[model samples]
Target chain A: MAKQFGLLARFKDTPDLFHAAEKVRDAGYRKWDTFAPLPIHGLPAAQGLGRSRVPVFTLIGGFCGFWIGLLMVWYMNLYDYPLLVGGMPFFSPIFPFPIAYELTILLAAFGTLIGMFVMNTLPQHYHPLFNSEQFLATSSDQFMIAIESSDPQFNTEATRLFLEEIGGTDIQVIEE
Target chain B: MATTTSNLPTCPAQAELLDQIRPAEHKETPLVGNKRDFPWVTEKICTIVESRVPTWWWVAFAMALFTASFTGVGLVWLVSTGVGVWGLANPVNWGWAIVNFVFWIGIGHAGTLISAILCLLKQGWRTSINRAAEAMTIFAVVCAGIFPLFHVGRVWFAWWLFPIPNSNAIWPQFRSPLEWDVFAVSTYGTVSALFWYMGMIPDLGTLRDRATLVLRRGMDETLTPLQRKVQTAIWTLRKYGYGIFAMGWRNAGNHWRNYEMAYLLLAGLSTPLVLSVHTIVSFDFAVSIIPGWHTTIFPPYFVAGAIFSGFGMVLTLMLPLRALYGFHDLITQRHIDNMCKICLGTGCIVGYAYIMEFFIAWYGANPFEEFAFINRAFGQYAWAYWIMFSCNVFVPQLFWFKAVRRNAAMVWIMSILINVGMWFERFVITVTSLANDFLPTSWGYYSPTIVDIFTFFGTFGLFSVLFLLFLKVLPIMPMGEVKFVMPQADPHGHGFGDTAQGANSEMKGGAH
Candidate 1:
């Protein structure tokens, strides 16, 4: 049997898309998403999506990098070889600040990148969303809402009518 | 009220009727063109990458390649012969190589200033120029990294600079600025490469999609086996390559939210790095005991000069290309004017630093420092010093005139002069301080050998080659970011409905 993908609706503009998102959220559809060419302000709130947790990952990465820098410098400079030059002391907090600061930033940047990918579940080369011919316009100048067929309340005919009522145009069923 | 009405030239009802007929016009200048719409932007920018390479691009590429090969030749000769092939002797051991290193590193600063700093400040003009500038930064650093790596003389043993466990268990000196430089430049290069690649991801998706369209159209009436195979290969490569990089960016609200957050944080992280990287580079000289090199003001002075030189190089590259590519709409007169203003401001700061160095040398009453300043202006290397002053200080002052800044030819000429002046500035700092050190007997006049000259020229070739190649491969402008600044980008804006209707029609027409 051919798998049922979802119902995809194209909106003419963002206001229409926002209103559609409100209706869909009110309809309590869990497995759905909105797409646009650029990030629309307040769209996430309109759909009632939860906040992302990438910042927490960044914080942890920063602290770990800070300690790694401090310890690496200490072990190498003081504990391991301890060659005294310019009559300066073996170990000091002041000397390692530059390396520590650099590491903190480097690790935090990596964390942000990794956390974003992890949270989004990206590098998804193939998705049912890509199966639609018109769906490519979502990355360009179009706004779209896709409610997966896997949603608990999804009905083939009823969902199409509901999308039309909410001002979605050119509604189509996506198949996998 | 009756008297006011009687004094009016026309009746109030008549005036009200006229006002209703003609609405007030708000004549604000757009950042780009008035006719620039979403499809126009996507088509225009992508076409640059999709089209065949132009004749001028080939000519430039050939020149860049010819010059860049000198680096290989020079390096091979340097490795076969010892460090003695070039000029490095008694007191003036730190010579042209160090000067070039500092010079190239300084040239890399403007990219970060445009991409990261201006981004934080919400400067929309940076969108058109940042991609190219960032590429330049990465390439310039590659050129800069070469000098220091070879300067250690035994290129094979350069790994000792890092803290890897060894049989001898000897560690690199942590307190030294040189060690800090090793970390700073490497970290800078890594972060810059990551940032550049991250920004290129969305544009890569556009290219991929465009390739798919072309492939699909070609597949409809394909003829030969060879053409079929080539088309399939090209399509597959673009699809997989873009797929991996773009990471499924659908411009979903949640994806953008996280992406924007990450981008902003990275910008914040890189801001301090801009100040820190050059400051540490400055410390290489300031921490020294040499009279002219050692100073409290070196950090800010070096930072200002770096920005000055960086902007100079940016203008030198951007002006000609902008004219040739007809990017005037995207990179407007205002953008050029703003960059010129920054160059002028930083140049003045550099000029002030020159004056203050002299003042401090006299005011502090340090004989070595006093002689160092006097010797720079009227000593054996006085010609170089005066050239630096004239180019760095005098040339930029031309920009104070509106006519000069607006004139592309004049700006280009001044930009080249500023770049030359900055190189000479580094040369004067490095050679002068070491040549006229405290001991008269140890002091010697330093001059570059043919090898030194070739090596330095080779680095420029290397930088140009990388940048030119980059221009061909990537979308030199950020199409996604540019869209954000467009008037029609806002969904709820007036006339958005009309714009959408036009876009829909255009999409439908293009689909067929």
Candidate 2:
């Protein structure tokens, strides 16, 4: 961690982040990030963060929810004291479907929310990213780009030359 | 350098000019770390839009109050005297009460339909109209609910509708269609209310951000303190809301997939419920061996009619109200066009149902059914039949043209006429069939008495009063959602082109 050199490139705004990122990537920097006061339109593509794995969790959640709903209805209607009227069949799926579908959705939704919170490492106590005072402006107005020095191709002189050539402003080294 | 930057003027003369013409300022509560000196809202704008309620709004509200009181008075007389006073005789047992109930409930379908359905379609137009429509849905459902509760003369025994069996040792006969109705209507009420409130939470937070101190205080009292603790309450809500209301909206990239899936599920669920509800209502007639009521097509036919009439009611309320409230930009010509298209489609479905019913009566070679259909067209209730025909079929035909569809006044008038036509259609269906069923000896003409008339009118009064109150208190539109829908919010275009200024700049090669 101490020996590795990271690339640092800052964008004055979100668009600058996008264009600068494309240039940096073309120049062969593998790992990087763009940050602004809010989510930027093209930053994710610039970071090369591929499609997320959130849906796999959601599907599993949905399946579990379906079975749980079925069991709840079964216990209440068939297991408990059964009362039948008008000769309608007991434990009819048509009648129970609304409640079942609602519960299935309820559980699945809960699972997805929890999964996202876990994956994002939310409620962080501390972050090395916060150590830079200039970075504090990212929460207010300025937009920034940080390319970790740890990438295989990262060389202090080469990366600094590359970032400056591509119109990056306020380049700096961020420590771990 | 830092001191110089701090000394820079907050707004130049040009920026102040821009602010004068187009108001822009953050009006949210001061957070612990806010660096800005003064908040955005000017004293004048706050005084006009957010000050004490104006007199005219109050006057209109009072009139609605008077109408509701009259309805209450009518109900008191109805309970004390009996069902006998208001035209529920032998052949015509169902009258104005059931008619209004079905009308109001049917009216509610449009709101949920617009919010849930269009959101799935990824239509940007929904942002403006969806907020008010959802509010209208809740109020209309409330209005519709009153009729069924009051229709049962023994109003005290309404609790019997629930599954709970008391000392009587009698379980509510699960086979009865009305019992299904109790579950369906109540469940619909619960889900719709939850969905509406969930949708409103973000908008309420937006209002919290934009509101004056007085308005903020009012909102604070309404929302739990815990709900207000976060600055990005609206953002957090959407993050979770898209999960809960949208049924686990993970895989942010596959937005279309999740949105489409959730929509299809809800649509599938609701379509059947829509069919089942009216079908059960029709079963009240169909299960009985009465000649006019024994048709199998009653379920789908009735459901189509319900959707038709419901859309009509929505257009009637939405068209004029949007104009009155200065929401024309949000509820645009395009929305009106889409609604008109649906109205025409459903209107045709209803027209087809009318024809099919007559054809079935002929095909079955049943004398009783034949006579019932013939009488509905040519007998004592012929006026209602023609009124239904003209409004449901003829008036809506104008929607086939783009010009008529886009014309606000024409569409508004047509929508009202369609509602009138729908009421007559229900009245015609319930009354004309029941009266003169098989035996001429029991045949009778049904007419609504003063109580029946007032009770139905009272429902309108109740619906208007609730809706007006909603406008005054809540953000009439979902502000946070509109902001999120802005091009600035979406990080990826995915497929569709972006719509906000931030996105526009990318197109023109400018600011991010």
Candidate 3:
């Protein structure tokens, strides 16, 4: 463990943690977060986070996939050594609809996956929160709120006191 | 009573009438076990993966391994000798290979239907069974994929199906239905695998965290050299492997927001696939000009049968599993009943399609089509046709009786019957139509060689081996999703109050 990273406080349940989030938000701290074992219905609004951008990525991916499917079919059948088999036209749009539709879905699904990881900045190998043994409870049944040292208003003493005042227990100073 | 309506019995009579007319409470059972807490859910599901293997598991695994090896041997013999080893010949070019391919692929459909379709509809009962079903989907597809690849005879040249650039400028036929099948099946496989893994991440984190706790507690204890090495390996792999797959999931608000969106998008994407994949597969037959194969109704009929067979396979696997592992609490009788209901509904649709096919054949006024239908019922393959009818159409009707659906043994037997009936359904469609076609001279009897029989049986072995391995290695149930549905998981509920105190008592309770 390195030097002091932040003050990590554990909450007994979601309501206590949710209330503490409101308090933290009202206090004007920017670099703090709350963790729970499952998604709390109102936690995002409580933390002031906005709508996710994954849908936008999916839209763009669908359009690209559609065009790619069209081009691949057209190029193979119409442009490259067109040996006509059936009496139908070489680049009939009607025939390619199935492949095009499938590609649209396939790429859109990939976009959602990639966009999520990029947006969340995931595959993060380590974090100071992992250093707090109590913080592991966030993945199971406990809720936690961590105020990082990087936050503008963070003070080792003042943050600890604020957390204690808000019904937060097992407050520990996490080390990097 | 009428004379004093205003004064005597107005209030009391109305209240009594309302009570009588009101529907009963319905008393729907819980999907999971009663009185289950957060830790209990996690412990119950994860313990299956962590505990010592039972004797039955060993016996089943050995049987699966033996069959899987037979599949390998079958494939080797297939590639070494040629497609000649099978009963495929003039006029009847397609045989057990195509039948098994369609059968396995149809079986794979239920998994996606359970996970994606039911999920989108907010069918809460799906939470208990979707994880295992999705795993089944992935494995069944693997078994399904082998047939087409080896059926091409020159297995080495199977890559010609794809549009990749090559030294030879010859491209695959753009309008071929076979080409469309390649894309549809491959995309289905990839998407299913991704969906299954994405769902497993949180549960994998639970396992990883649990293993970490055990490791830390045992650090001071003495151990034999072998035990020490084993523990060290498990610790290292669990830490790194799970760490990467979990993608730093801390259930933070932002993470949850993104995860939910991604999951929903994937489900939306997969829903269409559940319909489209089999529809395209049907095109491989319907687009042809053969008498029995050229019907306009193939797509919808195929989809219905796919779902029917898929549910049958789910029941066949889940019923035995629920009994063996004592997962009745999680996989309740209600779940079994619901699945049986789906099977029955789809089976009825399939039966109607059968009747419609015969009607259309006679109504169309084509001699070949009429003869094809007549031959199917009265010809040499009539036995297979009747088997398909009884097993698929008649057997599932038993589910109408609540007693039959609730009886695990009865359901198990019916599921096996449905599976056999479905396989015969495909066999009937493929063999009967092709065996007796336009010219009488081209008509021949199609009997599957021993190789064909072994190869089909081998795929079942492969499917079971993969499923059994999945059971031992991963959380067969989705603990994270299961927890979400439990009463205690509610943020505002008393469950959290108990959880809070429990957290205080054990500092690391959250980690568990």
Candidate 4:
């Protein structure tokens, strides 16, 4: 809590926070974010954020899992040590489909969890925002906007005025 | 109507809020009763975890712990003596162990159905109950895994089910249905846990915040005892403990964007995952060419029965907890009604599956199949068959009446009966089929030994203990998701919501 990290502003409610988000996006501030207790529908678009890249990871994991499951069956049964049982073909995909399918789901879930962590860069352990006691309420019953001082358009006085003009209350400079 | 319209405020936002609030032709029951607000939802759910344990909680926990100890001692004795202590004979090599396995795993389906399937369907009511239900799913799976692992007779060597390539260099039969079960149950356990924990993160943060707010004094000044000083130490642990597991969740919009995406994807993956688990489990019997088990309909039937039994278990757990905790607002009557309807619906499917099995046996004209069906209904195990039929089939039919469905006491009884019926259903399916097969000389009746009975009985204890711990430690309901379903959670709406706030305000003073 030494250097000014950003300008923090609290909004009255969701609609107010949502509108403020639109203004902040229009203001073209890149190093900024909005916080809410729960996911607000259409907030991402209002905040000028695109869809998440998590699905790509899930698909990649599923593809790898399916092939891995299938090949493992083949390797174990036919390549490594072939054994004859019930006069069935040694490496038939039909017999081993359940194993592969289960793996596909297993790995796909792994991918989704891993991908989400990667996308969010989570387990951050620390952030400048945590220093602001008022900001902690964002996890429960409050909505807030934080525009980082590192933004290219960082003017301390102007940014403070801009936030005040947008119906923000309890405006504070979060120190990092 | 004109006066009502004109009395509405001149503000357009206020007007739109009224229309949305009005009861239209498609009137639906209130999802959350008593009009609970966001903060109220968080406080109500979190305080249960934060406050001093109630006296009844201790009583219930002690009983569950006592019951679970039977399983612990039974398993130790089982491993020591060998699998022979159970009622294994010439025909019934597979006994109560397999029956309990299927029963426990089948009960887990409802949780997945509520959390994953209902989430996919956009069923908003699921928000209030999904967290507990998902926890039930994970715990039920743990109980289910024990029987199969130990029934292998060499519990220590259970790791051999997986293809880790030990010194033997030999591989498991990749084509075996039992092998498929190893993957399905393990994967189901892992993914269900992952889903349950992921959903809990935000709710955990809610708990963490409240716990962190006042570490010197416990959450409730009035409720804190002399032991509250001790609770402060626990609070310090909670702040960092829930903090670390909360994964630094600040409820930032960017994090939620990715989090929601992952949630939807997991739900998508879990749908097929849940369906496949029981399907593969059914294959363990169906592919084996056993007379009763060799049907094409086993997968769908098993899945339906699983859902039916799962919902029954949900009602069994939630109804008592709801009444004890005074969660009428959060877990409204509509929630109970809806679960009754699901139980009724799936119970019908199970009944139909039962009839269809018999129909196919007669229709197919195979002597073994015909004998299996007749013997199932009228054989030495006729008593079990009647129990499964009456409870699984006949008892649920009572839910067709609105009176029965709405009656909490009656529904609770039905839920218990439904569980009993389902357990017997599995017992009948596993034992009857194996007991009196093709050979008359080899056929013999299976009776569970003391160890077998105690082992199966112990699972209920194990399930209750885990659930009781969950009730005490975690936010039993998903507060964030429940808040998500409230009208005020809508982004475009004026904040106080139109529901009761606008209407009540306007009603108090017309022409505002």
lDDT of 2 by residue, B224-331 (tens): 677555423543443333223333211121222222233334433444444555666676667767777787888777777777777787788778766666555456
The local lDDT score (0 to 100) that residue B222 gets in candidate 1 is: 45
Worst window of 10 by summed lDDT in candidate 3 chain B? B1-10
- Model 4 residue runs over 4 Å out of place are B1-26, B216-231, B494-512
The DockQ leader among the candidates is 4
Candidate number with the higher TM-score (2 or 3) = 3
Candidate 4 chain A — worst ten consecutive residues by lDDT sum?
A131-140
Q: What are the per-residue Cα lDDT tens digits for candidate 4 across A1-176?
A: 37889999998666678889889989989989998888888888889898899999999989999999999999999999999998988999898999999999999999999998899888887888887778877777788999999999978899989999988889999998
Q: How many backbone clashes does candidate 4 have?
A: 0
| Winning model by TM-score | 4
DockQ of each: 0.37, 0.09, 0.39, 0.51
Q: What are the runs in model 1 whose C-alpha is more than 4 Å off?
A: A14-27, B1-28, B220-225, B494-512
Docking class of 4: medium
Give one digit per residue, the lDDT tens place, for model 3 in A1-176.
57878888888765677778878988999988888777666667777777789888888888888889889899988898576877878888888888888888888888888878877778776777776667775665678898889898999999899999988889988888
Residue range B1-512, candidate 4, lDDT tens digits: 00112474789998888778844432566577765566777778888987888999999999999999889888988999999998887799988888899999999999999989999999999999899899999999999999999999999888899999888888999889999999999999999999998888887777777666766334557655766667677899888888889887778888889989999999999999999999999998999888898988999999999999999999999999999999999898889989999999999999999999999999999999999989999999999999999999999999999999889999999999999999999989998999989888888989989999888888889999999999998889887788777766666553333453333433111112
**Where's the lowest-lDDT run of ten residues in candidate 2 chain B?**
B32-41
lDDT of 3 by residue, B1-512 (tens): 00112333458877777667732332446566654666777778878887788999999999999998878988888999999998999889999988998899999999999989998998979998999999999999999999999999999999998887778888878688888888889889988988898788777777766666666666435888888888778777776677778877666667877877788888899999879999998998998999999998999999999999999999999998998998888998889989999999999999999999999999999999999999998899999999999999999999999999888999999999999999999999999999999999888999998888888888889999999999998889887677666644545433333233333344223333
Q: Tell me chain A's TM-score in each of the predictions.
A: 0.96, 0.80, 0.94, 0.97
TM-score of the second chain of model 4 compared to its true counterpart: 0.91
- Angstrom error of the Cα, residue B506, model 1: value is 11
Better of 3 and 4 by TM-score: 4
- The TM-score measured for candidate 3 stands at 0.91
Q: Candidate 3: deviation at residue B480, Å?
A: 1.4
